[model samples]
Target chain A: MELTIKQKKKIRRAAIFTALLLFVLVWLLPVFGALLTSFRTMDDLMNNGFWRMPEKITFKNFGTAWSEGRLNRYLLNSFIITIPSLIGTLALSSMVGFALAKYKFKGNMALYLMFVAGMLIPFQILLIPVFKLSNELGIYNSYWGLIMIHLVFQMGFCSFFLRNYMITIPDELSEAARIDGASEFRIFYQIYLPLSKPALAALGTLEFTWIFNDYIWALVLLRDDKLKPVTAGLATLKGNFITSWSVLVAGAILATLPTIFVFIFLQKYFIKGLTMGSGK
Target chain B: MKRKFVPWMFLLLPLILYTIWVIAPTIYTFYLSFTEWDGLTSPQFIGLENYKYLFDDPTFYKSLINNLKWLIIFLAFPVVVGLFLAMLLSQDIKWARGFKASIYSPMILAPVVIGLIWSWIYQPQGGLLNNTLTYIGLKSLTRGWLSNPETALYAVIGAAVWRHTGYVMLLFLAGLTSISPTVIEASKIDGASAWQRFRFIILPLLKPTTVIVIVITMIQSLRAFDFVSMMTRGGPFNSTNVLAFYMYSEAFRNYNMGYGAAIAVILFLIMFVFIALYLRQIRKGELE
Candidate 1:
């Protein structure tokens, strides 16, 4: 059974293709199971088990998850917290980034290292202190507290990312703006910010997903059920409906929509932002 | 003086917010670790007592071992699988785009969502896993995966690995793109075997990406709190406990803020070692 060289190559290609298909199917099975479970009635799930085809499909779970589960209010709280955190984080970090990138002042390198190091530290250390601080400031259990913590804690990564990005912009534009007596703030706003659009867009998309998917911070700071964001709120729903697999799965799926949409539509920016500093 | 002051002006607000929120709290947590405060009282300084109790605690040892297990599994499974997937996709294969998208989609979902999905799959009585096993005549193998003490941590780690493999693959894909094709072609023309080319050329070139992957995975293992909290809550007699989740339970559930702070300090130190190594790598890369 002597095979031609081209035949050998075709066989190899087909083997690799089959391997990839198998891997993807296994990788996606959990998600598929969840989806299947989401549409089945409690009776169907109980009778058929999770691996079996549903006896009857239902849309009532999504409706129950939305209203009775209070997912509608939680979704609104998520938006309120995530949007402000995203905008404030970018705004503050871009300023610090501009200064560090464009200027060579005393403690410049030290400040940059501080941010890079701070961003990497496990945040569990700050849990108790942050909880108390929020309480003292009278912002505990409010959207403002979670928003502020997110804004500050996220600044380190955002600043480090933006500074690395802004460093690549030509210095001559800022130099010319400086010569024409443009204020530092004006120069940043007018020239550098606009020039850094691609970086901002990429970072904005990444930050949105991270902020929206936040559970730990919201769990710690927001005790009021009405104030919890979608992720934390979903956990409560899980607790309430532990026996009701369909409703719990429905809430989980609903909570996942925003980030999934971001990943699908703005995938290019998301990958670019994530892989920015890692690759050459 | 005016020129010098302008940069500070730009940095002022962020610096203020960062210091107040992040730096000060971190420093205070260090101080709190030394005191006997219930988070409500003025602290009584009881230096070294928390550390003393922690040193003898069985659960701490269990958690440390579990965390090490997580680190070992992540370093082995996801890194290898991710690199393999990236290598296959880098070929001129059809439907590569579709495969990449489907694999990477899990990374976008909230950990809560991922936890819920896997919870259903690992559910004891009518779980996907148990049902499939029974159907295939392996009924003896089926057990309550998440409820069994021996299997709980590994079961949760499997879910985490599922969510993380695509991220590692994407980074490697980026690293693969940066490699010059002429280098691979040159090896092929010289009659290099595929394995030989990978060993000699591709592996050496991918060092930076590998370092990044290893560091991120190590840190992620330390931060494996979310899934543990979501899936098992360190249950089945605390068999699945990790350092981060232990710290949370100690601080909030028991109101043992001081003891929790000490545990947090330990986690921070372990993670700090990796962060330092990563930063050094970044610095060397910048120099080059």
Candidate 2:
């Protein structure tokens, strides 16, 4: 039977909307269920189904999680590790990116490809050597160790990303600044850096989330409890509370909050940063 | 010509750090793979011995096979399913932004949190999955998900898939946006059915996205460590051990640094092969 264009349009729209809604539910069910479980009491968890509404909500889990889990200390450690790593990665990447993007030099493509290859090399492959080197340098189990490694590992991709972005800005802007008696460094700081704020914001959010979510590096480099980030702290909590469902759930929720909060609040920049490296 | 040394100066800090932390370690790993050193002992060149032992080791073979399985099965979760969702949501739909945000939220959480949450859901008797099955009178279908040797690897992969599908979807969504809307409208005006439109127009347009998804997923699968370490620790008799976790256990836990370095070299070779292939493909695509 021949269908009118209006009927076909309506049908297509309905089918697409229904499928999207179903997909959304499938994607959200696990996250929502986990969030609910975080609020559930051990009694409620054991006696009732995960889908069932709780009899009463409890703030004690969050309280216990914050104190006993030592999440406060872990939060500080995470900030110390992530904030410096973010700043260091951004600053270094931008400086390197500016040079690579703007300057005509020998082996420029080779240098860029080296960074690209570095991005593809797995952290597992680097584990033993990096660990040994860290120990040899007397920086093992220290905050400096974590920060330095994060900066080194992240430098390649960060520089590659920023370089690609920096190339897109009109050369005339930097050239104009240079013609007005600006030094190369001055052009980078006063002209390029100011115009690159949006890109920096985007990369900053991406780097923050990546550094905050890093676990293996922390697990290997940090052995001291005082220096462990939230990921490692949460993993320790899981090991200690192996059978305590409420505490474990609470810890997971607390551990995830910072990243989730960053993503939700700065979602525009986060998404932009993620796709930025992909466009080229 | 006016500033020949300026760019070189800019390259100084990054180059030094990369040489020390990256290139040097890579070369050192290659050397250590051939020596009998345990981080403290004097190195003795053991030539081919570590490689021979790895080939003969059953656990090593199991880990390799499990890694392959992860690469295969994990690809479907993120790439295929994510593409399907992206295609569905790309059409004009209500609450599309909300749907996208909900789906992508899981990717933002730390792997440790995702691992812990899923571990609870997959708990044997009183957990969310088992409880749901029992409540619906399908108790026989439910079993120890993460603990059972038969299902342990697959169970962890399921959790990983759940966490990553949103990420893949985001990539596809971006790809979808870049596609010219006029092409889709033209197909519709040509009286093409929905399936026809997708099969002929949309799917072909998404080749670049597919390539990106494949490369990223392959790398991610190769780096599969955190979830396995957190969830099962390659337990139930090493049923779920991947190369990453296996290498960690060998190096840190067992102190077999030489053998671990050998394993690390093998993993690096495998990844290097894929990356080489990906770069080649991208180059070919560019040429075309």
Top candidate when judged by DockQ against the true structure:
1
Q: Would you list the C-alpha lDDT of every candidate in the order shown?
A: 0.90, 0.86
Candidate 1 Cα outliers beyond 4 Å, as residue runs: A277-280
* Tens digit of per-residue lDDT, candidate 2, span B1-288: 669999987889989998988999888889989988777887789999999999999999999999999999978667888888888778678898898888888888888788888899899855888988898889899999998999999999988888888888889989989899999889989999889998999889888877878888898899989999989999889999999999999988898889999999999999998777666654464356
Tell me how far the alpha carbon of residue A7 in candidate 1 is from the true structure, in angstroms, after superposition: 2.9
Per-candidate clash tally: 0, 0
Which residue pairs collide in model 2, if any? Answer: none
- The worst-scoring run of ten residues by lDDT in candidate 2 chain A lies at A271-280
Q: At residue B235, what lDDT does model 1 achieve?
A: 93
Q: Can you tell me which runs of candidate 2 are displaced by over 4 Å? A: A1-3, B281-288
Best by TM-score, which number? 1
Measured on C-alpha atoms, candidate 1 has an lDDT of: 0.90
Interface RMSD to the true structure, each candidate: 1.4, 1.6
Best lDDT among the predictions, by candidate number:
1
